[model samples]
Target: MQFTSGYGAEPGAWRLPGANLRSYTDMDQFVRYAQAAERGKIQLLFFADTPVLDVDLERQVPHFAIDPLLVMTSIARETERIGLVSTASTTFNEPYSLARQFKALDVISHGRAGWNAVTTSDPAAAANFGRAVPPRAEKYERAHEVLQIVQALWGSWEKDAWVLDVDGKRFADMDRIQPVDLQGRHVASRGPLPIPPSEQGQPVIFQAGGGGYGLELAGRYADGVYANPYTIEDGQAQRQALRDAAERAGRDPDEVKMFAGFMPAIAGSRRAALDRRRFLDESVDLRQRVRYLGAMIGLPLGYRQIDEPLTADQLADAVPSPHDPRSARALEVAREGWTLRDVLAHGVIDYHPVVAGTATDVADHMQQWFEAGACDGFSLAIDGYHDGVDAFVDQVVPLLQERGLFHLDYEGPTLRDHLHAREQYGLDPRVTETAAR
Candidate 1:
């Protein structure tokens, strides 16, 4: 799931005819999306979060308005099997608090919770905490230390710590519970988490971010990786890199699943899908499109003609803005000689690859990537919210299931069971089900 709101991955999604603008704050909207994904036996519904109001709300609808964990909690009650994952920044939050919250969520969901650890780069989020944004190196370093503390906290309480001895009149075992006392360069914690492990043990750890320090953190701790790769080849290389990193950290490489982010625009036919993409592309007003294009290339383009070709010098001068790290992808498209209009039409502002096609077409693309070692699966986003999820679940999922590439039903009750679904796809020879640590 891209979001639990009306506005999806498409920037102009809210402007579509009959779009529900009120769904952003409505709890029922999230329940609908979660139930729909559950019907398809989708492994998980992921929600991305930013603590600050980062977008220009006057122009674009803010997607990260509500707390994702709170929303996921509501969804967790409404749905039975689908996994619920939410982003929580390691940079700004305390390790013990986040660890406790996620553990409680896991217990509440009966082991269907996942936490996406991120080193948030948004400077506005830093301002909310009355601190300047830390440098890239420092942020990742802190993230490493924080994750260590959180993991230790999660494991503090032994499986049998909460004992109920009716005959003996003793209800607990103090010796079984241990305190975590770890001191790192950036953070330290001393505690035994009050919450014990849930049915599947601790919540699955997912790491989001891509280069150097990010890979190291994921390799050491994450059971899954959330990634954005613009091309299949890039995805394949990233998978190999993650696997290598895991192996270097003395963990099983295959245990670290990479879910590359992809947004698909699906319809009954290929031409219709393309037309839907076009409709979404033209939904935004020209001025807003110009602003978006300018933001993508880090330039002021309100004065420039929309159809005019950007010069080589202009493309060369383009650099990533402080807030938007995806600007480079747009510049890459512009350097290929696309006009400003063409760039926006191609949706270059988003770093995730988009597929506009029929159900079969989408299924074929996913199958090819999986077979080619590009990714274990995708972190799917939609062209629209409710309709987009229904279209894929109704249309594309059956095709994948028919081809034996996906599970027809969930193999187990926990999120880890769904992820490590044994004997389902047979894509990896080493695939196995192991309890979460």
Candidate 2:
């Protein structure tokens, strides 16, 4: 599950009753949240990031307050079993340093760390990095090279590279260590990585993207793929697309796991859940929603006629901005012939599937999607105060476990153990062999 700080992508979540306004900065609170996830045996706790103040300063609460790596480092000390996935942009960071940092984290967390590689889209982030944003094609090309270099560096040291001999006065088998003398068009790195492999090998690689380049990167390298599938059909199509991409790249399709983003306004009862969703929707300003709709449709939508449904032609022609890839979900909702108000209330702008129901209802939705081959798993977005996290862990998780859809306890200690359980169950022969190696 992914939650950096505060409610994920919800502008009005901080203002909810009993919400923690200080969640963005509280280290103790983050530890508590991580522990809650560990209790439910969640495979990964993902942290999304950008190196800029991306949130709206006037209205929205600050989300990415602390660096993700730092927060994960703290949580690493607090939790033992749950995996820590920290976001690092290929756009801003150099490959050698990024690889070394995550390798160190993997060591610290005892193979329970994951690197969420991202090509940042926020234009403002370029100013912080002291460069102009590269063109989309150029950015993706660089990202590909960066990932390649990082992976090569991670594998530079062989499993038996460290001899640790004192009497022989040799600490490492120099012959076993190979230098990654990569001279790629976008980035280059030299020499074998200094750190030895952790118990789970290197940190697991994760990638999130909607475009072709992004999908290709995930298929080629990512062990886990973070995705935004707005509906069941979208999820199935994305899952098949990723599997196709993996096969085209000469990989086992089952090795690449898809994790769809999910944010639900859950309550004890179905009626209460709907009421909670309504309250959350009403908290946001109408003008902001109008702006969101206009951005999604790539047109100037007037708030005066917010109740009127957009014309079919307008919805059909709507092409999302390359930077704002999530706009497609809003366009999808618009294609359903819903009015601007209804689309806004549905919160399609965040580009995640939303559910509002009791624990049983939530479990049913998840089970249906899983059984239908919609996605491998869900990357839950917890509420700001952690109420959602507690509720899901305390309620929905047990129900799923009872149905034999979820694990009653963690199968093993390392993140790879948690992730590779499906492979061990015979999802793919090569993947099982690779995990064993």
Candidate 3:
């Protein structure tokens, strides 16, 4: 199945000195951008977020971003066809609330809302939630239980739940109004949810985790997965595992779409693209970049200044576990002792796979992955906002269109239908008191 291109919107993208800050903060700008994405024939607009603000980030730019769900609702009114996805942390919120918000957004947007379900992993997030330290593996365990409860809640109200019999004085049919009185390890909500079944039946369940437990959690429920796979080979392997696991869990294996996060640098020429990447490196402040990188792979680099080669022991000792059950790609890089200097110089730390010849070259790379079954689709990450998207649309998208890999038009009115998803779940709500990691 061919997947659609989705953009991850972060507010501080167009970081030009004296640039109009109003564009990032204003809801109107989001509306304009959503329209622009549709004009480019982009299929989805997803916002990935965490609850805790980076105190350090405020030093660089003013933090004035609106809520993703609210922003998505505004964008939904302004545009058509582009899927609106938002990150909702499962750890701090109840399943009922999360389900309600997503279902309501789906209704308001005519069935275009998407839920990127995440368990907030940051320690600061734990602090914000009144935990001295976040529950480690248990958070994911509870998340598993929570997913079950939410799925059941979505199922609570069947597609034919409402029997509007006005002549008989019946407001609705109580028979179809299934009550998902759920209880789980960490989440519990008794319902009959307030809303009827959403337009698509349920909001798309988008998951982001990279472990055996995480995999099991996804196989049982999620319709899509967001993975930061470094290479096409890694993506393909993970996709296979996801399919195999889902099938084992009695779900349609093909129902789960795999998406790899990709940041491509494209220009008129290969040299120009290379130069652009180099410029991105040179322009970024090294220390701050190092700290950012440190946080990503779970390192505390800012606290220490030892210039030594990293070892397997050092990497393994610091991290509670390997990056995941199957792969230790991040740990492998850390073990090689890639310092901040080396990382910036080589782009080897979070090595982004690039496609940099002409437009043909980039298309060739994309086609290679598609043929290899690396992913059902991709989430395109821009180095900057519109400029990066502009290059892809101007150069690579046409090439893809010519190659028969790109969609000339949208398939359906709703995002769920646009993605060509089959309804895997019916209203059989799995109720639980709380979640298990």
**Per-candidate local distance difference test:** 0.79, 0.79, 0.66
lDDT of 3 by residue, 267-373 (tens): 77766665555555544566776665565566676624423445455566555234533124444445656554543333444334544446677788778888889
Which window of ten consecutive residues has the lowest lDDT sum in model 3?
A: 1-10
lDDT of 2 at 86: 82
Clashes of 3: 19
lDDT of 2 by residue, 311-384 (tens): 86676677876566567677877777767776665556655776667888889989999988999999887544
Question: What stretches of model 3 exceed 4 Å from their correct place?
Answer: 1-13, 17-19, 58-65, 132-134, 163-171, 287-347, 355-358, 424-437
Q: Against the correct fold, how does model 2 do in TM-score?
A: 0.83
Best by TM-score: 1
Candidate 3 residue-wise lDDT at 352: 46
Better of 1 and 2 by TM-score: 1
User: Per-residue lDDT for 402 in model 1?
Assistant: 95
- Global local distance difference test of model 2: 0.79
